[model samples]
Target: MYRDGAYVSEHVRPTTHAQIQPNGVDLTLDAIFEPLEPGRITRNDTEIGKRQRVASAELDRKVPETYYLEPGGYVVRYDEVVEIPEGHVGFVYPRSSLMRNGCMLDTAVWDAGYEGRGEGLLEVHHDIELERGARIAQLVFAEADHEGTYEGTYQGENYETPRD
Candidate 1:
């Protein structure tokens, strides 16, 4: 069975009340990066290419920072940290607003026991301006059976300290 948004909220940090949906919790964009070189993935080894963080324009002190992107691909990091509980797998889906704006967010399965401020590949079909902390994706959890919890290299990624 899939967990409701209220249940999912317990696993995410720094979430506003507006970010909670009926079925999932929304995630906001923290930063964007552009790949500088090609990455590699082998049967036993993998290496991500170097990337440069995209700079956002600060219009005014009262306004939020905004990223003006052309039609292209970029990597986006979520602002909120998430902890996937045991016996449940987390799935992230792009918010409808993104699709309506001609963009798509692709993410990998968040295995059980995974904890991090994760990232996703953003494909923009049209020029778009994204504001920092704008809701971009929604995370939902579904029950699943597994032999053990995740302990891969990506576990606890992008976190300065473990959540209590």
Candidate 2:
């Protein structure tokens, strides 16, 4: 069963009344990063599990209020920090407004007991201007019957971007 807005709000940081939906919480774009080098992934090497190297340049929000994303891929950080509790998992979903603009967000599941200011891959099929702090995605939590909590490489990651 999915958690209601009240329950989800208790676990998310830097939230506003308007940002909380009936079933999920809306997430805003905090920063945008453009890949500076090629990224790689391999299934065989244990050392290469998540060590894929890729340099990136964070776009400056001072120069332009909105970042013009051409037809390409970019990484985005959410303004809010989330902490998924035990026995529950979290999922990020793209906002309909972003989909209407030919943009898609690819995200990973937030395993139980994971906490972070999450990042997601944004694919723009058409040129679009995204304002800083624009709501692009929604985070929803659901119940899960897991014997153990998440203790992966990305646990407690990206904690600095959330507002105070």
Candidate 3:
């Protein structure tokens, strides 16, 4: 049976051109998270541009895709949110097909109650420069019996279901 919210993506089924894959969800090259300066753009020759998160001030910095990921890089977008239940765990992996072709994404993990939006960070492997919004990899959500409390603070808040 289907857990969490039923598969309600633009296209229904396990996998699609832009849908999350069963084994792994595909990552589309689209809008990426912002990583800029706080107030005045910090000046530094070596430090081109990077993202920094501050909890005390609840501030973030975003920049454009100037620096690539090692051999290569990418800015990925998702069609759906990868949600999970409290005390459960999830994993974000690159689609095997994409790996074989070219480009890859960093392995992401979603804990219980991981909610925000279907978005993620991608690390391209090999080399295949493509336009933004291209399908990159796939995300895999598994059912794990991880008993933990979703409290306190972090990135945002772990996505919650069965109550939303």
Candidate 4:
């Protein structure tokens, strides 16, 4: 079963009225980053390679903000810090508003017991203007049974954000 808005608000921290939806909570964009080089992952290897680091630009939330992307991909950090409840997994879905604007947010399954600020890949198919702190994606939780909690490489990662 999927969690409702009230349950999510009670469990998730740093939530706002505008961020809570009927079924999911909205996540805001804090900063945007571009990859300095190509990235790869090996299926057999459990240990992931070191990520290519590139400086990210902070999104200004005060005014009507816009960031231009030139038909490429970028990584966006969500401002919310989420803590998945026991026996539940989280999923991030791109807001329809973003898709209507010729962009897509690609996200990974947020495993049960994963806790931290999360990131998603924003693929811009055309030049688009994105508002700072805009609700670009929704984080939804669903019930799942797992043998153990997530304790992999990315566990408890990206928890602290200078922007917050």
Per-residue alpha-carbon lDDT of candidate 3 for residues 1-164, written as tens digits (9 for 90 to 100): 22332232322222454454434455454344444644343454233246542111112322322222334343344534445555456666666666775656675566676554444555555644443445555545556676664442333432331111
Q: How close is candidate 3 to the true structure, as a TM-score?
A: 0.50
Deviation in Å, model 4, residue 96 alpha carbon: 0.4
Q: TM-score of each candidate?
A: 0.94, 0.83, 0.50, 0.85
lDDT of 1 by residue, 65-140 (tens): 8898888899998989999999999999999999999999999999999998999999999999898899999999
Which residue pairs overlap in candidate 2's backbone? Answer: none
Cα error, residue 119 of model 3, in Å, equals: 5.6
Please provide, for model 4 over 1-164, each residue's C-alpha lDDT reduced to its tens digit, 9 standing for 90 to 100: 99997787765668999889999999998777777655566785554334443332245542645565678888888877888888998889999989998999999998888888888999999887776678899989899998898887777777765763
Rate residue 106 of model 3 by lDDT: 74
* Model 1, residue 85: C-alpha shift (Å): 0.4
Task: Report the lDDT of model 1 for residue 136.
Answer: 95
Off by over 4 Å in 3: 1-25, 32-49, 52-70, 73-79, 118-121, 149-164
Order the candidates by lDDT, highest first — what do you get? 1, 2, 4, 3
Worst 10-residue lDDT window for candidate 3 reads 53-62
Best by lDDT: 1
Q: In terms of TM-score, how similar is model 4 to the real structure?
A: 0.85
The CA-based lDDT of model 2 is what? Answer: 0.81
